[model samples]
Target: MTLPTITATRYVLPLREGGSLPGVVEGNDLGTYVIKFHGAGQGPKALVAEIIVGELFRRLGLRVPELKLIQLDPAIGKSEPDFEIQELLIRSAGLNLAVDFLPGSFGYDGSAGNPGDQAMARILWLDAFVANVDRSWRNTNLLVWHKNLWLIDHGAALYFHHSWMPAEKFATLPYDASDHVFSIATPDVPGVDAELAAAITPELLTEVIGLVPNEWLEDGDRERYLDYLTARLDKRSAWLPGGAR
Candidate 1:
């Protein structure tokens, strides 16, 4: 597949958690984008959350940003001031959101309200399976674009990494990865319906995944993401209604 390429010219400013990164695009090629890193010094599992579960969302049919990894030498960012694009999604306080654990209930509002329950239910199920505890309306993990809802920033999935496990233990997943609650052919959930799950596509998964930058997984973890996504597409995709069958 032909993935979009970008070059870093200037370092963007620091974002939430005080981690600074660069914002870049196809340098001189004409396009707008915001690039970010997993973290400082040693990378964190949050990067895994973004790549792994982000792709999962695509497979389950969700709108997400075209993301990628860009490399900005520490010298460039530390020496210069970079502008980071503020995420369009935000809480009532208007703070940037990070998915890792919802503080409380913060559902939808207006003619498009019930999203809180339906979407939240699906997300809760996904989190239980992947061990993701973050993401919720309160934290603004959900995005609003042209009156449509979208998922973003999955930096805290597969929380089991905190525990030490034998290789065999890792082989047999301890979580249930089912979408029965939000099937493409099940009862409706008030404002939302199972129809939404049907939107997932292999091409869309491939496409959004194409946005992940090499720098983000700079330490060979990129291969892990590629393999994780590919394997899930073949393995866990069945959890998605109309995913394979």
Candidate 2:
């Protein structure tokens, strides 16, 4: 099923910590969301990565906040005094990506206790699968809500897609797992890889890609993205910990 799109009703506050200048927006659906703007320095590619990778995690049975397409109205930026934010809001006065806001959520200090072996392994494996380079110790990009770990800030994943090289060229690239904030030790990498391999089928990948809006696609970019992901999924052994076996 596809996610619902909602119009932002109110801009509550800016999340200064995020590099993209995401803001807390109240949607017409009576939901609070953390929105990522299309005009951010990272560009629309970041939003695409967020939707694809985040949905992939959800399909894998992992914990991630619900995502939505947020429609931003420029009038909301007129009241803002910050020139930078006002300009960004004006530029991004269109469709953007938002994640459901979890109240009382706190940054993961790596002290709320471990996520266990299976969970950690699956997370690491997914990171490797997508070549996410931002999950280091310095910025976990993870949140704690209701005593469970929730993944967030996935715009940095899928870096390989940004390059001009043919997708197959980077499909075999190696991913360094040492910097992962959560320890990868003792996790069943091979098992998780096998499970995900079976679960992330062709139809599922297409569905995840379909979540992205057409306006975000430039020329053949969407088809290229789908081709790259499908190719990587078929040749996952090169990037995955264990061979695709």
Candidate 3:
């Protein structure tokens, strides 16, 4: 399995754990990172939100936080909301500032408008397909470090809780799959502003895709993802229908 470059000895810190415990590592030179575990299930899942969805969004060219998986143990650190969260944060060999964020410039209510709607619509579609339900403002798990919208926490995707979801609950799944949302509530709601879209160069997409955790994708998924984005960027008419109007 693809894992972050970590040390034989690890240091886990005990911080207040809600969704994830903020942590620091000693080796590999990777700064702060979120951590998670293998095959984690809901209610009992090691980590909550911020796994596949976050990484996948990054692959699709959204700004997402740095992530990695680390060795786990209470001795390494205490106060684990769950092992999954602990593993992701601690294992990441990169800087972990995932602990902070403010809207405005991050991705919402900016002097312009939503940071990137057509792109976000794809994120929403991906989330819907994977069954992630924690992207709203209340949980905007995304962090805006250095004036960029970074996605965080996605251990909550891929419909793990379905094992217990009742027949009535399944209805939402069908509704979520619909494309009515692939656009926006109104056609005029310009997404992210033209300047931002104009600035999203292939180099930026490559850089963001490079950040995607290897473990999240099956081999070659990265190339396919990059290809998918190239196709999407080439076909902006589908994502940014408002622009056509």
lDDT string for model 1 (183-238, tens) is 32222222232343334354555555455544433465444444443443334333
List lDDT for all candidates, in order: 0.43, 0.85, 0.45
lDDT, candidate 3, equals 0.45
Model 1, position 23, has a per-residue lDDT of 29
Where does candidate 1 stray beyond 4 Å? 1-3, 17-29, 39-44, 81-112, 116-120, 162-164, 167-245
Tell me how far the alpha carbon of residue 82 in candidate 3 is from the true structure, in angstroms, after superposition.
15
All models, RMSD in angstroms: 9.4, 1.6, 8.8
Clashing pairs in 1: 11-82, 12-82, 13-82, 67-211, 68-213, 69-213, 100-133, 100-134, 100-135, 101-134
Q: Model 3 over residues 136-160: C-alpha lDDT tens digits? A: 5555555555656566666555443
Query: Could you tell me the lDDT of residue 17 within candidate 3?
Result: 41
1-245 per-residue lDDT for model 2 (tens digits): 66689999998989997578998999999999999999998888899999999998988888889999999999988878999999988899999998999999998877899888888888888888888989888899899999999999899988876774678876777777778875454246777777787888888888898899989887887678778878877787787764444
Ranking by lDDT: 2, 3, 1
Model 1 TM-score (2 dp):
0.52
Best candidate, lDDT: 2
Cα-based lDDT at residue 37, candidate 3? 36
